[model samples]
Target: MKKIKPLFLLLILNTISYAQGCSDAGICSVGNSFSNEIQESKNGIELGSIFGKGEADVISISSYITYTRNFSERFSLSGKVTYSQASGEFGTRGQFGDAYAIGNYKFKKMTNKQWSSLFGFKFPFSSANLKINGYPIPLDYQASLGTFDAIVGITFNYKKWDFNSALQLPIINNNKNSYFKEYSGTDDFPSTNLFERKPDVLFRSNYTLKTTNQKFTFRPNLLFIYHLGEDSYKNIFGNRERISGSEGLTINGNLITSYSINSKSSIELSLATPFVVRTIRPDGLTRSITAGFTYKRSF
Candidate 1:
């Protein structure tokens, strides 16, 4: 349709505006418009897949299933579980990443503007200590971060624009990886043994466009993720050392297109790439480009 022209223009403009970002670790993907879709519906489910290339020439694939139930107009809850795999010349490793639960609440006092808050928790599957050929592989090859994380965010929507801010904080770290000791020097892996990650802060802005029929929707977003502190790792001597250059910011531009297949079903696609990056990304979250597909069903 003629309206599609603006969607492409928005995508181009979004990429140009950054001129410069993420490597995302599970923040921007949640709480779209504070999950208003799930809020409006009584119940829903989603299945999705995301394909990405990470550091050290590793390729990653993630599949997830989500279910949401609405308790009322002001509150809703959703739960998700994911399975992820990473493979490359180093080797292949696959496992469950984490289980996530998100709770969304809308503000009743905000009559003129839509404001919502989100809180969630991430439960890990196991210690991120996958081995290959008797040697420990780097974070890029592990499916899970091996940390229990707490996520809290707030969203604001006004007309055609949306804004969000969130934080992903590690509450408990059980990462037992020792890849650096075995592969850092010999295999040219980044030296991040026993990886301990810091919390991340996120800021996202987007503009949404829809066709007259509302069957088609396009959203272009710019996401910023900031590593809050210097990450630490255990060295050869068993002494903890700070990984300098680990604390920095990454910016990414993303575009999402969605189509409605009747009322209860829809398909969505998204593409994202970074414009700027930090010198180091030890959390195994770097992605040069990412593409994803998702299908949703409402009940």
Candidate 2:
């Protein structure tokens, strides 16, 4: 009983520390130290759902499948495909979402710490075809923006703590109908513009605690994100228009729990919510919950 006291206290504090930040990390940032959890797995598969509600009484739900493969001792590759649906005060939309690929390389290693860099690309796969009463809706309900994005990230791990940061930049312009094209009459709103891509920077840190028996683990995380600029677009009248107050900062807290089902598999539950918002975001998620399971087997 005496030996379990410290461990029990840590468990209690971890549960209260709370997780995931902004749209950038979502549930993926919760308790994901990356160094051991991902590198140790030869091949792994994960299926999960993300559900959130935010401004304008909007609710966003997405389902995703992620696969990871370790090609070498220090190199790994992963991919994710998602389907998302959203509805609420604005409108409703359902479609396949962006697909992304990630590659990681570990360049430094020590007895208890590791450092790695990751690069990835996100491919646009969904169409922005949301309508209301046969009229085009706003951009808030679309599942995808149809832009190709490149991501670069770095991660560091020490013991049970992890730190990671990533930058996401859109490399290709979205040319699809990602704009407000419908109004009562074309003459009334003839200058609607299509949004341009913007950049996102995200940072997250987390600590994990494992039960003495090692069957369960608890993790708490803090996250921050900054938007570099507001989205811009060309209006129907050929004028450049910028979405004001789009650039801002977000802070979030996250908590995650994982239970080992066996030596090769585990189930995870995660929660993420924003604690601060410092901008005019007309389209953003404020809170989300995720439940998923992961399975790993040697190849």
Candidate 3:
């Protein structure tokens, strides 16, 4: 019985290390970029599932409150907090909570315009807690991974068609420390350092089509991720090892259909899938699917 606590903590740590980048529950940076166009009044919620290639599967739910205020004709700011949880078979379960604040400055903008450019920065802070029971013993642990990112992008809007391309660079990387503690008691156990702040770069492109009524929209996006620094990947199952570099290509297509219940209220549903590229396979090649909905209102 005394051994159960340590084992549980280890399981939690393991789940977080491998599952961080794979889950779809967190606030997607790209999604926030378009917040200005979304009718602002109430918050939104998205519930989805994450399917891994093998034994790893996750069901996730995320929600956010978006506020968009335009200070000038070309400047706007949006802030939101997103929470998500992932649970699967084999006693694998994890939760991620994130808060993001982003400011967008538009270079050129017109209603139903075909071209626009925006410079922005996204400061996202996140915390994760994981737990697994199937291990020889129960394991539970928590970690905080946070980073500040700068973004520059160009958007093209053609009637009902919208296209966006963007690049993101991490300006400040926050290294998080992981510690082990007894699951039941206030005892401190050996600590393990899981991840360090390393430079990260991301490129993404998206295309969206608006319905005739402009209430429904369909968006498909391609995201490419590259790690620019020598960051180490360690887990409860092994010793500290450094990953030379990492790259991932993900294609996510989401169908968001919105119904204007009234002038101030709307509901939306989104479905998305991420296909894995060989260059970015961490444990191995993987694939995932995410689907959810959101309810929004305008003040």
Best by lDDT: 1
TM-score of each: 0.90, 0.80, 0.61
Cα RMSD for candidates in order: 3.0, 5.2, 11.8
TM-score of 2: 0.80
Quality of model 1 by C-alpha lDDT = 0.78
Between prediction 1 and prediction 2, which has the larger lDDT? 1
lDDT of each: 0.78, 0.63, 0.44
**Per-candidate clash tally:** 6, 5, 6
Winner by TM-score: 1
Error of 3 at 67 (Å): 2.3
lDDT of 2 by residue, 35-134 (tens): 5554455887777776655444556777777787888778888888877787875457778877878888886578888888888887867545455666
For model 3, residues 1-299, the per-residue Cα lDDT tens digits are 24434533443343333323332212244444543363343333322222332223433334456665656655666665554444444333444444555565555656666455556554444432233452311111221244565666666665545556555565665534443323323332222245443443445555555556766555544555444545454455657655443343444333344567777676765444444432433222233433345665545
Q: Where does candidate 1 have its weakest 10-residue lDDT segment?
A: 15-24
| Model 3 pairs in collision | 8-138, 8-139, 8-140, 9-139, 9-140, 41-297
lDDT of 2: 0.63
Which ranges in model 3 have alpha carbons more than 4 Å from their true place?
1-28, 35-55, 88-96, 110-144, 175-193, 197-215, 220-231, 234-240, 275-287
lDDT of 2 at 121: 83
